[model samples]
Target: MSNLPPQHASEGLSLADQVAHELREDIIGGRLLSGMALVEADLVNRYNASRNTVREALHQLGREGLATYVRNKGVMVRRLGVAEVRDLFLVRRTLEIQAILGSKPLREYQSDRMLDAIEAAELARDREDWQAFGTHSLRFHQHIVGLLRSPLLDAFFTNIAAQMRLVFAVAPDEENFQRPWLERDHEIHDLLAAGHRQAAAEGMNRYLDDSEHALLDLLSHPTRA
Candidate 1:
């Protein structure tokens, strides 16, 4: 593989952004694994970046709850404890159900956008693209909430998405696990667009329940890094 200096890695991306994006991908894709130690000098040599830049990048990840920095021991990729997993799903359930129930009658165009997000998610899943799948999956749900037209709901869902990213890191075969949801999500969007608000809400609830169950099942076997 060709090695490029981190400072010149990509155009239009700051050094800190480049470092953060690279490390974030490693964390989310399970390449770095949970609780893996993040050494500054090692990363600095690996990315050919300055220590200051690496620290700034790690700070960003830390803020997202993707990593934790400890004095003397340095930083490590954050893993979701069992309780953390339960809390994440609980919060997600509350936000999503509210979004669905509060959504106004969906118009045709609005429904189309929702369908588009589902299709994107499905395609990403088929390609085993975990990063794309996670992002598109969040978009699918966020679009459902967007129908509600509430800024508070929007912000809540956004934070939920970030937390879900950590969960995705622990899930086995995340793409395969998300496939069914993608199909069901498309149907839910169709139902809402058809103005079947009650049915849409019901479908959303079932989706959340099943998703939470699956994630919990996966978490039952937390492997060491």
Candidate 2:
């Protein structure tokens, strides 16, 4: 228990949702490793939340497939098997390819969001803010999906983005590792804005392929991780 003051658990969002977000982010960001038991009493004390809130939060995480409830081991962060990582990336490729294809001609408002997200990503990179970059990069792509004007697609892509980030958290040298993706993503955005949707989609496909390959390779050989 570090001496950092606990945040008021009831400050804003519903207690359960707030706790869920905190725990989810930590698990996905690698602050909490896979298979680490989530002791509810410890969390209640750490976040100054009630036990019920902690349990509700754990349940939420389990629903997201970020945690598991064991018969005697309590809640623990999930460990993605190699096959699962590949399946996840395959899902990402399909969804993102569709998002780019459907986005068609990019609008000014959507471009603005993309640029803002890119700038935020660059700033986060400069400051070594991997967490922020991971989050904002997802937002950048979500904005692209939003431009397609399909709420269903937006929701689908959001879930895909979350899972990708969770997979990314387990990789080693993530800061340097993600640079290639960032570069390709930047180029893809430019192409999309310049009315080259096909080219942008192509670039996105290649990016997804490389990302999936790298992540799968890492997971297969944790000794190199």
Candidate 3:
């Protein structure tokens, strides 16, 4: 692979840190799919980094549960199983529902962030850019969890989103799989914005149930996807 332009390192981030952050975003953004080999040599060339930097980046992904070391295969994207999917959904429900129903007052900036994600997803869908649509859709939920104002939960959910996108990679039809959630996200946002917390919570519950069921079904029957 030809070497690409150097990463624009964030302030205070080392080259290795920048490489790892970019790789993490690729996973969360659906550019890297589950079970795909993360070849060190190619990555070193692609990111314009040394072998050590590339190895460190891959190790970061491994620590984040997004990559793994295979004896002969080196490192590859971690292939998730059904049990992890179920457990992820459980955590999704717990955190998202509390964010909606908890006594903490809703913040305007948080609401605007969610709206921005929804509008971005809508734009992506309009352009038939399903991959970008999926990223924004995931961001919508991440912002929902952000409403709680806890940095720890926000960070945890970022990892969850990355892992969840790996599962999303297996969907046979991206448009068909992701279109409904866009509408549901909008509806829930509307309810919450109008101060209808109970209704929003109910809509969120339904959304989570439907989403978890669909994903579990897809994982259980890969042939269907």
- Measured by TM-score, the strongest candidate is 3
How far off is model 1, as Cα RMSD?
A: 5.4
- TM-score versus the correct structure, for each prediction: 0.70, 0.79, 0.89
Task: Quote the lDDT for 164 in model 3.
Answer: 90
Score candidate 1 by lDDT: 0.73
Q: Candidate order by lDDT, highest to lowest?
A: 3, 2, 1
lDDT of 2 by residue, 1-225 (tens): 322224644445577877776775564444776677999999999878889988988898788777888778978877777787778767766666777787757778888888898888899899988777777777776776676688777756654565666677766777766655567668988998998878888988888788778878887776564
- Each model's lDDT comes to 0.73, 0.74, 0.86
Q: How accurate is candidate 3 locally (lDDT)?
A: 0.86
lDDT of 3 at 15: 76
C-alpha RMSD values across all candidates: 5.4, 4.3, 2.8
Q: How many backbone clashes does candidate 2 have?
A: 0
Which 10-residue span in candidate 1 carries the lowest summed lDDT?
1-10
Candidate 1, residues 19-133: lDDT per residue as tens digits? Answer: 7777765654446766779888888998888999989988988886778976777798777766887887787767767776777777777777787877787777778886677
Error of 2 at 157 (Å): 3.9
- lDDT winner, 2 or 3: 3
Highest lDDT against the true fold, candidate: 3
Candidate 3 residue pairs that clash = none
